[model samples]
Target: MKKEYAVIGLGRFGGSICKALSEEGLEVMAMDMNEDRVNEYAKIASHAVIGDSTDESVLKNLGIRNFDHVIVAIGENIQASILTTIMLKELGVKMVTVKAQNDYHEKVLNKIGADRIVHPERDMGRRIAHKIISNNVLDYLELSDEYSLIEIVANSRLAGHSLLDLDIRARYGINIVAIKRGKEVIVSPLADEMIQKEDILIVIGAVADIGRFEKREMQNDY
Candidate 1:
């Protein structure tokens, strides 16, 4: 059976999610208070409705509880987002995800039983900033406030060493999650797998340790 998802907002974030879900062949219920926005997505989604997501009666009437997951993506209005998330949880939706505009919004969503909180704008900004600052840093994803997954090029110092010789975890307190060699990716690279010049190492560790590895060790390589 196709997974059913309900997106309760018609803003860019919510609309993009609805479109992506539909493209992925999932059944999506796209809801919005604006009639025009709902009609626009009605063509793309399995069902699109004009409704006030913050209203409990409207949610109940839509049978939102039957959805596998509900995403509250209302932008600007933290009140509506929080209320909708709470109502959805009370309506017995299996999972609820919310797009938070800020830290306070995220905290409130968490307290209201939102299963997941996404900070799309903030996360993207951080990723762009990191890429701008370090030419060698290809990508970055924050796993937690203190930990992250990073991608950095294998510089000269690491060109010929095997995973066993590097011992990243023991030496730098990081793990090489994967290695990208040109177009190919080797996940969980084995100890015998050798590193090559320009290989992009996908690493995961505490943010501070990754900074150390990039600045002190990798940058100084000849």
Candidate 2:
């Protein structure tokens, strides 16, 4: 079944998510106080409206509670964000995801029962730092504060080694969940499957363990 979503902001952060969700063919409504921003997303969402989301009457009229998820991506205006979130929860929204402008904003959102809080700048910084630390790191995704999923390009030193040879899980405390070789992906790779240089390894583990594994395994002399 397709889920319904409503994005309550048309700023850069909110716009990107609205577009991505639309591209996936999901039913999404984009809302904002800016007439121009709502006009811009008219064709990108199932519906686009210019209105103040903190207004309970506007939300009730739009039947906001029926949507599966609501994303409060309002920018800068922390008070409006908080008010809108409180109204959504009060109206019985199934899930609420909010963008935090700072640590204090996140704490407030948490206390108000937001299901998820995203810090775009901080997460992007972590990804950039990982890329700077090693050329092998292709991408980084934080599963939580402690764990992450990372994509690493296999170096020549890892070419001939099979899963059993390296004992990756036992040695590095990480699991190579999948291997992407060109257009092919091997999921849950067998212990005997030998790795080839340049294969993209999708790994997940504790952040500290991944740093140690990358330092000792990926940064060593060939």
Candidate 3:
């Protein structure tokens, strides 16, 4: 069955999610206290309504409990975000993802049983910092505080070698899950698969281990 999603607070974060989900042909309900914001998304979302999600009665009337997932994206109003998340869980929302304003907010959401907590600003900053600091790191995705998935471009030092020859896993505790060569992608590359210069290696490992691998393999003068 197709999952149902509702985004409360028609701000940039919530509105972007509603549009992206709807673009993928998913049913999305866009809710907000501002009539203008709700109206703006009426044509984009499956359903758009102006109401305060923090009010339990409002959520009940909107049939929020039937949605598979609800995202609390209320801007600035920390109290409203917390109350809305609480109501959503109390009403048996299958998944409640809340956006945290800070560390304290995330702690509260975690204690209250939020299915997921997102710190957009903090996560984005980490991504940008990785790109700025590493010449070989093409991209980065944080799987958790301790682990990450990184894309690193192979250079002369890593070229002309195979997975078995490098023995990267034994040394750095990271896995090269895939290799992106121009337009083709090789997933779960075999030990004999040759590493070519400029190939994008999709690597995953603990953050500290990845950093160590980067310092030793990717950033050293050859």
The digit string of per-residue lDDT tens for model 1 on 5-64 reads 999998999999999999999999999999999999999999999999888899989999
Tens digit of per-residue lDDT, candidate 3, span 1-222? 999999998888888888999999999999999999999999999999999887889899988899999999998899999999999999999999999999999999998889999988788898888888778888999998899999999978899999999999999999999999999999999999999999999999999999898888887737
Question: Using Cα atoms with residue i matched to residue i, what is each candidate's TM-score against the true structure?
Answer: 0.91, 0.94, 0.93
Residue pairs in collision within model 2 = none
**Which run of 10 residues does model 2 get worst, by summed lDDT?**
212-221
Question: What is the overall TM-score of model 3 with all chains considered together?
Answer: 0.93
**Shift of residue 190 alpha carbon in model 1, Å:** 2.9
Q: Which is the leading candidate under lDDT?
A: 2
Model 2 bad stretches (over 4 Å): none
List, residue by residue over 113-171, the lDDT tens digit for candidate 2.
99999998889999999999999999999999899999999998788999999898999
Model 1 residue 171 CA deviation (Å) reads 2.9
The clash count of every prediction, one per candidate, is 0, 0, 0
lDDT of each: 0.90, 0.96, 0.92
lDDT, candidate 3, equals 0.92
Instruction: Write the candidate numbers in order of decreasing lDDT.
Output: 2, 3, 1
